[model samples]
Target: MTRMRAKPGRRTPVGRDSRDSLRRFVEMLAEKHPPLSLDAADLTIKDPEQVRRRFGRVFGYLTRVELEVERNVLELRVLMPESTETDRIFYEQVWWPQELQHGVLLDAAQQGFGMMPVPIDVARVSARIRVTGALSHLPGMLGVIRLLYYLTGAATERSAVIAYSRLLDGLRAMGEHAIAETVIAPIRRQEPGHFAYYRGSAEALVKEEGLSDWQLQLARILRRRSFAPVGVTSRRQRADFGDVARALHLDRDLPAVARQISLVEHELLWAQQLGLKVPRYIMAALDEAIALSTARSAAQSVRN
Candidate 1:
């Protein structure tokens, strides 16, 4: 776990509007949007030679997406001690199952084309992260951490939406209509609601009294220091992320995606510096990881 420094602030009262918004969001999540059914009909790929080949790459990406559910269980525990149980109930019962099914569907698609699903190593929280979580049980720390989680979640889901949209388009262009509708479409539909929760929480929490300038400063530092693609701690995962980016032609669009992620944070922390731009660590990590993956593939070809 990454560590940082900041003074604790006072807890702020949640506004009626914010509270109402959360209630509505939670209710919406409780409402059923049934998970995708992965049957032979929906799983059918129209252009196996073209689309399935690319889906082999998409499988790499979806595995990471699905695995985040497991990681988020731990993340919810660490970031929001006050609401962990409530959030955990929703995640385990609802969100986790849906996203995990997305992984299952994608994995099935990959298997249809005879590709293996990428292995996921569930991340263990480091001592620093545990200490941070414990410290969050203190007065001011929880608010800041929770705010960071919302910001992170919003950005992550936004990026996923973009990636999935483009991937669906790519598949359709390759005449893989079934995959465009069946696999990617349902998966993409699920993400926006997740983004809405995070965006709404970040917006609401930032205005609360408990959040302070020092905590915001610490958040800025954490955003800069700790930001990376989901489940990308290891070199192998990073390489896989790189391969997916290239396969989806996302290398160019990534900077734009990073900016979208940074927008809410920039407004929260440095309104005057709204125009401020720093190198996006996520983009750099993907680029470097992709380079490593590419080199390894080339080396393997030579070996073969």
Candidate 2:
């Protein structure tokens, strides 16, 4: 007869402590990032073709990332030895579909520009490889793995909101009035809900697991290494930052870019919520860049 190893003990169901902490975290995130109503916003597209093309490019990138996330979540489910039905439902039914919606909204917007949506196979492959590698060693530690997952999710969703807000604000300042509501509005609407779910889930896991200081530190390290801003992986996409600056009629200098970065820092609520140290030199550099940009913009305006 073949010998079989005994399975490990099941984790306790998420208890009151976890639930209460999660509730508080959810409230905190909601307060920090207020939800904007798309219905109330005017979403008219002035230059339908231009707006469409931009949507196609941006959505094409987003679709890939979403697919990868989906694959990663799936792997987690498969590899997990024990999971509560509630947790399973949240992952498979709720979170998965919500992420897919982000891509769907972008796809619909892309179709408006007369471009064909690319298949998400590339994203699928990349996700499978990366997630497989990450979770390969933690086959049975689903709870801990999930805690890490949700924390990264929280950070990523927040980054998306910050990036979209800036993009929308830039478009409005550039007189590309209609694209803000029509193109960016739907994407933004879905993001808050995504952020809420992950933030809530992460806080609950942290409290339930009674994560140690080392665990939290490990989580942060993992998040910083694996996480990236949505649709911002390449030099080409980075160049889109310049396009956004140009659209706003902002100076396309290093200082202007630094100012944009500063805005990102503010939107993230870095010092207060993130509680990370920003080097003094970095802050000084940002100040100097802002000054230079201001001087250059003034010089150009006077000549004109």
Candidate 3:
């Protein structure tokens, strides 16, 4: 038999022209993150009815968060009132539709599970909110905002990937393979595209604005205060982390949550590359937990 060269699978390139970057980002978002194969027998759903019931709670929360993000973008546009030719087109044609699509996808996912979609209404804030956001949009401030947005975005997307990956693992452990493959896996795949967009946009924005050390410090501070897990938010009295943790059956301990958050921060290499200023409380907790986990594994190996 003749030797043949191997072909590469479809994967996005990290460093590339903006058009290529954007295209790859979109493809990954649209196609790659979701899982295609699952063995239903491997899942742990003991009662289909209970699974169906819980699905409503999970889907409702996700839909609402998606809408909240869209509203933020819309309101930002309203406040800034984009006057530039380019800004207007970008907001009208690109950003608006993308955020809206997030809501649409979440709704579709909810409908697939026979759940009612959640309603979202943007809070009416005075122009002061816009003015503050605009001030942050100054050439210097905009660079900081863009960096924080994208870096935090990278952190957020990576967190989604990890969280969903764990969800799937739990599903498989529970023998709920169908939902894992159909619902959870698909949502996981969408994250990479979101990640790519944030990463690409951050690179472009940083380069364009010539970011400074002070600006970078500011970005980190803002990111920590504003960070929220993807597909969930810590906003409004109605939206609580406890609700999310319960729905996902995630570990409720502060250390565990901090570890998961740190996994996201580590995956994105934000702390090192971006010099992100993570909260000391989170950092201390994660450090101790990680150290203990590592030491346990090492001790186990020695015993073996």
Candidate 4:
């Protein structure tokens, strides 16, 4: 059995509102939306050619990222050494199990279209992450890191909610309602809970002075300088995310989507600049990803 690594002095949060909110949400995880059942998928592929042509890339990308939840948990354990027991319960217990099921289900969906399982990176946690974990061990650093996690989680899930919705529509338009209802709908339903968990916790922390001036300042600087698109650690993955964004039509409303993704961060970290339309780091990452993806597609077309 793999040991669940944690730091000393880690405990549950003491406050009532945020703690209670998260605690209630965790309870709701099992009660509200138990792990998705791949066994129950209707698994009907209406048109293999159409499904492959329209959704294969998006499904493959989503499946690989979702399946990488194990790696994410490992990263979390290393990066948030000061995590409370509640945090552990949420990430390791509630979140991972559901997200893992999502991966399995999505893989099943992609395979239904005759596509092989997308490869996932579930083992390596990388040297850069370990160094960040080292920083997390410092005083007051855990809270900063945890908040960043919450903010990022909110943006990521929000993106999923939108993407899944678009996928559902496309599937329905193609008369692929069986997979849409069985796979896409259930997965999309569970996403908001994850988003709520992150958004509520981040909002509460921001509301209650859960951080200090210097810490907040440092957080702002780090966020502006170091922010990357969620789950993107490589140029290939970045381009894949851009493809997912464009496939889901997220690129059509980049400013609005960017604002929604970074809402909590804007309110919490960006100096009350209510007028801040989009965070430069996020928009820039997406733009670059889209550019790379477009160039690659153009090159492929030329070669063909």
lDDT of 1: 0.69
Best by lDDT: 4
Best by TM-score: 4
lDDT of 1 by residue, 97-172 (tens): 7777788887777776677667665566666677778878876778778777777776777778877888889878
Q: lDDT per residue, candidate 4, 1-304, as tens digits? A: 1212223443323233567767877887868888899999888997988899878889999898789999999999988877878779888888899999999999988898899987789999999789988998788787778778888898889878888999999999999999999999999999988887887777666555357766777778888777777678889888888877777787888888887777767766773566666778888987888888888888889999
Give RMSD (Å) of candidate 1 vs. truth. 5.4
- Model 2 segments beyond 4 Å from truth? 1-44, 49-56, 67-69, 78-84, 122-143, 170-179, 231-275, 278-304
lDDT: which is higher, 2 or 4?
Answer: 4
If both were scored by lDDT, which would come out higher, candidate 1 or candidate 2?
A: 1
For model 1, what is the error of residue 41's alpha carbon versus the real structure, in angstroms, after optimal superposition? 6.2
CA lDDT, every prediction?
0.69, 0.50, 0.53, 0.81
Question: Cα deviation in Å at residue 73, candidate 3?
Answer: 3.0
Model 1: residue 18 alpha-carbon error in angstroms: 0.8
Q: Worst ten-residue run, lDDT, model 1?
A: 5-14
Ranking by lDDT: 4, 1, 3, 2
**For candidate 2, lDDT tens digit of each residue in 118-147?**
565422335544564466466334555666
Runs with alpha carbons beyond 4 Å of true place in candidate 3: 1-13, 16-48, 52-56, 76-116, 122-129, 170-178, 203-209, 230-239, 252-304
- Among all windows of 10 consecutive residues in model 3, the one with the lowest summed lDDT is 1-10
RMSDs, each prediction? Answer: 5.4, 10.6, 11.6, 6.5
Output the TM-score of candidate 2.
Answer: 0.55
